[model samples]
Target: MIDSHAHLDLADFDHDRAELFNAMALKGINSALIPAISEQRWENQLAIAQQYHCYFALGIHPWYVPEDINASLVSLENMLAKHAANDRLVAVGECGLDKLKPDFDRQQQLLSGQLKIAINMEYPVILHGVKCHQELLSLLNRFPNPKGGVIHGFYGAPELASRYIELGYKLGIGGLLLNPKAKKLRKTITELDIKHFIIETDSPSMTPYNATEKRNTPLILPNVASEIANLQKKTTVFILERLNKNFSQLFELS
Candidate 1:
């Protein structure tokens, strides 16, 4: 199983990160998408991937767009160019627009810049579009068939959901759907073509509904998989296998 998205480099997991990785391995989730959030995180993320044999994504997140954004983005281009052929560098993001962020203008600029980067590099993106779905959809539509990317933590209407899939983008179904109260997302996810969906934990952030611990670990993947299974009226095994295939295709995992 691919975690599809996670931030294992964040300090929150300093204590049990290894144990959590071991637990995930034992759970048959042998790989994960470890997204880089900031310049401070690049070395740690690479070190963690070197240590754990996982994948890494490097891009400036929208929320953290700096005053000298060009410098940071240039750093990202250099990072990708240097490591593009490295098997461990799986995707081009943890990057995209975030309307909820404090600086919408900077976020939009950063998002467009990264989208261009992803297209140029031909790497799939772990996108982070939130309330700006329409804006993103419009951008994607500019290409009759864009290379496509994952809309991480997707929580949108069914019509908009279809619009993303129609645009060649895959929807990421994660912690949000675990809530029975989130009927709208649940229904939208259920109706989505399994081929166009990727299961993600977004661990260390969006924990399952009854999460008792403050730190969300990848070991809890089974619970999230179970929730998705229940929604699809299928077994956990079936869900994981299908999700695994979807993730492998998205990230070109072996």
Candidate 2:
């Protein structure tokens, strides 16, 4: 399985980072996509991908946008250009709008800049939208026929999700599905085609309900797949197979 949106570089895994990778491998997690939240982590993210033989995405995250947004964007663009042909660099984000955070306008500007880069390079993106789906959809529509991407940790309604699907984006299903009380999201998932979805852990965050006291990891991906399968009334093997194919197609992975 591919853990499509895991922040494995976060300090949470500092002590057992290598062990975590082994655990993920043992649990059948074939690859993971570690996204950069800031320019500071871009090199570290790439190093982690190289060391672990996984994948990574480079973009300024909404929450971590710098004071000089333009300069930061310049840095991001330079980095993207430097790694334009790097096979491990699969996408252009972990970038998007977060209404709950400060400087909404700045966030939009940063995301727009990165989106332009992604679109120009024909690279898929890994987005993080919270309470700003409509605004995000608008920004996405600005580009004509942009390459597809994934909306990580999607908890929006079916209509919003369908809008993204229509725009050539896939929804990332994370630990949110583990909560039995997330009936609305579960129902939305049921209504959507499984092809429009991908499984992610968003690890070191979004800990599954079953792992109440522990930091989340790619090791929990099978349980995530099982829950998704249960929600879709499909078998676990079928869900895994479909998710693998979807991940491969979305990231152009082998």
lDDT of 2 at 118: 87
lDDT of 2 by residue, 1-254 (tens): 88999999888988999988888788888789898899998888888888888789999899997999899988988998899788889898899999999999999999988888888888888999999987999999986446689999998779878888989999999988988888878988788878989999898899977685688888878887998898889999999999999998999977
Worst-scoring 10-residue span by lDDT in model 2: 139-148
Candidate 1, residue 38: CA error in Å? 1.4
Best by lDDT: 2
Candidate 1 runs further than 4 Å off: 143-145
Task: Give me the overall lDDT of model 2.
Answer: 0.88
The 10-residue segment with the lowest total lDDT in model 1: 138-147
Model 1: per-residue Cα lDDT at residue 13: 81
- Please report the TM-score between candidate 2 and the true structure: 0.96
User: Per-residue lDDT for 63-161 in model 1, tens only?
Assistant: 788788778778889999999778889787888777887888878777777777888888877788878877777766653325577889887767888
Q: Model 2 has how many clashing residue pairs?
A: 0
